[model samples]
Target: MTSIEPEQSSELVLRLKSGDVLAYEIIYNVFVKELLATAYKKTGDRVLAEELVQNIFISIWEKRESLVIINLRAYLFGSLKLSVINHIRSLVIENKYKEYKQVSFQEDYQDTSNLVDLQDLSGLIEEGLNSLPTKTQEVFRLSRYGNQSTKDISSKLKISEKAVEYHITRSLKRLKQYLKKFYIFLYL
Candidate 1:
């Protein structure tokens, strides 16, 4: 087990390095089951352990030409240790992502849709009002929200009724253009 009988293993390594399929098969047959068991014990996951063992064999075959192994059994087990560590790290990252998604879903569901929309629309209206000239904004608020007639607005402000109508029209046109980006503006 230490060196596959310690005498023939050097010959086996040389042949395996020279791309001898039979030597590779002999090494795999000797070590695969033990490696699989070690991987399974470390990972506690049968499928992942089997896959890790398979990858270890594949790595040995791929690196045969460059390898300088004093003990093949130790090398395979060392590879298994690294694979198990990587698997555990991936599980931790996956758990963190699941937790993040769950928190995001709860936050999304807790938000009141109507309240959000109303707040957004009010903000847009306030921004549009700020963009208007002071007199036009005053005329628009009185005519629309204050329920004042155009003649009353003009009389109170000491302007002609025609001038009040012009201010209201200008303010409405400017606000319409400013709010055009919002979907609710189409209905208004």
Candidate 2:
């Protein structure tokens, strides 16, 4: 790291807070490589580290007017650490979402092997539906099996749309609760 004298560093920080583009350029030139190296060491990805460092500089420039920096080097390193951590967290979340989507797609994919499971699940679902209140069971049947829209079901049943929605929601919740043990796959 290029060491700037304490007085000079403080002056540069004041100039940066005043929106002096020259001071900002000087700071960037001095700290960019060090920040890049720090990010690269942590992330172990050249492109990502470069992007992180670039983003830090961008943020500093954009928020320069409100920035309060007692020590330029320390502030730059702190920013780099935070950016790296956030990047890692984002990557982890993205990977988890991808995994979830892959598993969901696999489960949804139809195959001859799942035929028996589908039939059994249908029978179990029918049994659970039968156990619901008559109005709820009817609403659920019209919405799901009959593929009728909520508006159509409400009009046909002489009930408000909100009531139809409530019945369908209640039926689904009850069915899921009642068949929780036998329909383990449904939870996914």
Candidate 3:
């Protein structure tokens, strides 16, 4: 198995996107060892690094059809960085919870104004929600307010899970964009 050069990896990605198995093999051979090295550098644990590298390769293969890698090396490195950060963060949070029993909180304070703000925001949100497309709004509402899982909504609405996910993601993206615009307008 010949190791593909960095320039060749980009070509391999393009070919893989076009469903070329040889390109996939070439790309994997070139990047897999480097990816595992990055994982080991980030994690400082050989076993865990090996597992993360395995998952990363699996994810890459699974997503090959939709993958558009501008820089395969950078993407792999960034993924390894994020995976390590997530692992460390999870360990920190777990340790904090484990030690929570030893901490004493003798005083408790309550703020009534925060509750009022939440109520006002709830009303304002509902008033503006009608501006969204009906299907998008329904998907957003079911996922956010009705506390329904996407799978549940998909089954309830008789739509594919992908469609449900699309609607929900699109709805949230639009809402965020609108909110940013509104905030800018207010400042201007």
What is candidate 1's local distance difference test score?
0.85
| Order of models, best TM-score first | 2, 1, 3
Clash count per candidate: 0, 0, 0
| Candidate models: Cα lDDT each | 0.85, 0.88, 0.77
Clashing pairs in 1: none
* lDDT (Cα) of model 3: 0.77
Query: For candidate 2, lDDT tens digit of each residue in 91-184?
Result: 9999999999998888777554488777777788998898888999999999999999999999999999999999999988987876676667
Clashing pairs in 3: none
Query: Model 3: which ten-residue window has the lowest total lDDT?
Result: 101-110
Q: Judged by lDDT against the true structure, how good is candidate 2?
A: 0.88
Candidate number that wins on lDDT, 2 or 3: 2
Backbone clash pairs in model 1 (N, Cα, C under 3 Å; residues 3+ apart or in different chains), count: 0
Collision pairs in model 2: none
What TM-score should be assigned to candidate 3? 0.48
The TM-score values for the models, in the order shown, are: 0.57, 0.59, 0.48
Position 124, candidate 3: lDDT: 52
State the displacement of the C-alpha of residue 77, model 2, in Å, after optimal TM-score superposition: 0.4
* Model 1 Cα lDDT, one tens digit per residue, 3-114: 3876677788889899999999999888888888888888888898899989988988999999987776677789889988898999999999999999988778656655
